[model samples]
Target: MVNEISNPAAVVDEETFSVRRTIRIAASVDKVWRAVAEPEHVSRWFGLVALDGAGVGATGTMTFPDYGVIPLRVEAFDEPNLISYRWGNDDAADARPDVLDPEKSTVFTFTLEPVDGGTQLTVVESGFERTSAPLENLESHRTGWNEELDKLVALVEGEA
Candidate 1:
């Protein structure tokens, strides 16, 4: 039997300055929602998330052990279906501001849909053109979404 999760690698669109990836997880939308929207669950698969508050307009940081803390904000949320976060994506910067810089931030939105047996999750990270190195950051985030979302699939599916 072939053992694989139906997840396509992330793609970087130069024209749009964005990275997009979609994956199917053997877990319900509710389960997947928690994994992506909750900071604790997100930290398990992605960066170490620390939000000052909850829901839209909340501001905080996601601390990656290797990459350090980056300013982040909850840009949008819609129950268990959608959640969008804007975070600093300036890969070439030597220092990061304590607050999210709208001009230099990229927003990554997670949209969840119910499927026959699980959930279809798609994440699109955009606004890379405003970052320091658009091309490099686009590719970096493209690779990042693949790795991070795969970890998320494992975490959510394992629990289900």
Candidate 2:
């Protein structure tokens, strides 16, 4: 059976260790899922590409031409709701402080919740044991997720 745990309310922000990052997006769950889950759609907004992962139990890859390609394995895929993945590649770029550990995969999750105006999308990335990889990765992703989230909002709102 899959083990699911509720995300903590507070994030860790220490010096030596801690792995937690959360960002919110403005869009419906369905819209966000479309913008993020599908390979074609994801390439248009989020990452460079979406490999095998499309539906539940899908495994593939995501890449950034400037950086490199990383293997992506989907774990939790609940349509129009949640999508989780393990990302990392063997390329040298994956060794950077900002990049995730290729040996130790990290968990990338998207949680959608309904709100007054539209859906609220929360992205939480954890499982960063390697300090160097998470360093630059965490900061870079901070901006990346925000931009991608906004793009998803635009795509969904425009369709509506």
Candidate 2 regions exceeding 4 Å error are 1-27, 89-102
Give TM-scores for every candidate, taking all chains together and pairing residue i with residue i: 0.94, 0.69
Predicted model with the maximum lDDT: 1
Error of 1 at 53 (Å): 1.5
Give the per-residue Cα lDDT of candidate 2 at 61.
66
Tell me the whole-model lDDT of each prediction, alpha carbons only. Answer: 0.88, 0.60
**Per-residue lDDT of candidate 1, residues 39-70 (tens digit):** 99999999999998889998888998888889
Deviation of model 2 at 104, angstroms? 2.7
Per-residue error for 112 in candidate 1, Å, reads 0.3
Give candidate 1's whole-model lDDT. 0.88
List candidate 1 segments past 4 Å from native.
1-3
* Poorest stretch of ten by lDDT in candidate 1: 1-10
